[model samples]
Target: MKKHNWSIVLLFLLFVSLSISCKKKQPVDADPPEGTESNLVSAEVTGSYNSNQLRLLALAAEYDAAVPFIKYDVSFIKINYKTTYKGNEIVASGMLVVPKNMPTAPSMISAQHGTTFLAAAAPSNVPQFAAFTGYELLSSAGFITAIPDFIGYGASKNVIHPYYDEYHSAIAVRDMLTAVTAYLKKEKTAFTERLFMIGYSEGGYVTIAAQKTIETSPIPGLSLKAVAAGAGGYDVTSIVSAIIDNGTYSDPAYVAFILNSYNITYGWNRPLTDFFREPYAGRIPVLLDGTNHASAISDQLIADPTALLNPVFYANMQNSNGELALKAAFATNSLLDFVPATATRLYHGTADETVFFQNSQLTFDKYKASGASKLELVPVPGGTHESTVLPMMLNALPWFQSLDK
Candidate 1:
């Protein structure tokens, strides 16, 4: 078995994490209609930035001039919105970045962030840093951007993050967009009603999930224009099998996260010891408690799946009929079946190890075979999971700008 490089995985999480709603007011005199109530719970202005100030911030963040320069001053607002979780309604939080003084009605983007365990790294919590790297900077480029905290953090922090769960992930993005649309309309922020999606890694999975939901179900007042997803684990079963079969994976933290998330999200209620080895299993709950960073968690885990996971559980996961519930969950959550109708581009680093480039390739091939003419696959030469992000952004931003009309 190849000894994986832990440092790169650590750096990937650190670098990506480092990088990467309101309610309407009720009338005093008369109550609003029952179904007419806004999805938006509340919005609070966090900060405002002028174009020049945003330009300097982008430069400091190392974004090249090839990317769109700051074109409009922007306001950052933290918003809470009503979104569903496992058939129950709950309030979730996100960051809404609205551009000021645009020449025309600006388009909107649901910018999803890569995976992060730390709550502080959630977009609404770290608005300024997110502004430049996550979604805020794009707002400065004149698009209204909404970055949802994705259920495990922000207002829904107590809930288990349904990592890689299709329905939960899709609803988080969809409802946030719905809430944002209501908020923008309430505030009289002019937007073109053209919606775009962008994300990398886990965000990439989320972008695709949201795109599929919107394209298929058709959200009222939310029209998806285009999307760019990079290095996502869309083929969930294949990715998990590869990890188990390969014996060693560079990022054990990710493996733990998925297992734990699946266990909780699916109501499997399996003990961590059923999946992971003793000491690591004992430590998993503490490691994933929304305070530790991914790097910190990775530091404590072994890279070899055989060593990190229980021998029986690992062996069972390899068999088709074994671990039936978990297998069903993985199959259900995988994004392989959908053929996106909207213009879409799947981006992947050819050398990416964490989520594997093959995941995207397989997805692109499937979509193409299903007759998705507007789909394209973009390979970032020599880009690893961490390195692929900047290049992906550089290419995606321009492409999104071209289609922004």
Candidate 2:
């Protein structure tokens, strides 16, 4: 009789323990607060360039005019488009470029910018860097170009730029296209009927997110023809592991940007004082502006981001920090998981040092294994992440041209 009583007591305790554990493991609600300014703002696109601001505007417009015309004929026009998402007015400022004379093209390609310190503010100057080499090639091939400065980057008003939040990035892409389409319909502009997206690095992830959103959302009059992602840091979990394991060659600005972005998004996670540890954090922002300057690379502004944090700080980062929250957000808003079993083109350089090519390969394999019928993985041999854009564009040009046929 005593044995039976003890067994019952033990079973009761076990049940209680399991209940507590399950409660603790329950996920926090991932839905962002509605009616918040970030959630309600509409996107507006405009050209702030004028003759009086010629130098800056010229600098801004240089990429559209110069880069695409390098090997083929291309011309671009600057325009502003606006739209609302959620409940707030959001503004997106960008350029629209197409082949010099092809007015009746069948497809439009939206190119996303990578992790430049300037974000998309200096779009005109970005294409010169090997990072954006594909933009020109895509434009030259008669694909209409639409690029957004992701919220908080260019003219958009926001405190922190969402680093890896696919929803925010995807929305930016979607709104830009919506605005452009509206403009075309209103003006009766002759252009392509199909919509395609292309992006690299940070932009590549955004491209994937945008494609997923478009496929699922109720945005009328928009059709995604195809998508191309190159060297995108798709899996943030893996990227964070790489940063923690290999502290060398990590960009300090990226770490700062991530920390800042997370703190802004989830202030409850960590205190602001926990960030900007020392002279390094204080001075890092100034150094970021020089990211594209030739002298900056030699100064070793890039270093292991993990090295800057102690174990306690790192532990805090992993726990309540926005990085994990961002991941949860992605999982909750996984538009890509439901992507049609269509083939989306993916390109990655085997020797990419920035974002691992294996990551791209894994994503491609996952999609293919899942019965994704419309997927293509193109390997760029003898190419690194930064050097493959031009070649990828060259390879994609024929494909872009085929959309018309």
Specify the highest-TM-score model's number: 1
* Candidate 2 clash figure, as a count: 21
The sequence of per-residue lDDT tens digits that candidate 2 reaches over residues 1-405 is: 012454445434543443343222222222223432122122222222122222222224332233433332443344344534333566645555544455454367888877665543434322222223236345554566776667655445443556777667787777767666655554455665667778887888888888777777734555667677788867666665566567574455565656556555555456534654555555555554433432353243446545465445666556756446645653544333544443478889988877778777877777777778888989899778667765666565566556544
- The lDDT values for all models are 0.81, 0.57
The per-prediction tally of clashing pairs is: 10, 21
Which stretches of model 1 miss by more than 4 angstroms?
1-35, 65-68, 128-133
Task: Name the regions of candidate 2 deviating beyond 4 angstroms.
Answer: 1-75, 83-87, 103-106, 119-121, 124-137, 268-277, 285-302, 315-340
lDDT of 1 by residue, 179-297 (tens): 78777777667788788899989999999999888988887777788899998899999898988888578888999999999999888898899999989999999999988877799
The per-residue C-alpha lDDT of model 2 at residue 156 equals: 56
Model 2 poorest 10 in a row by lDDT: 43-52
TM-score for each candidate, following the candidate numbering: 0.90, 0.71
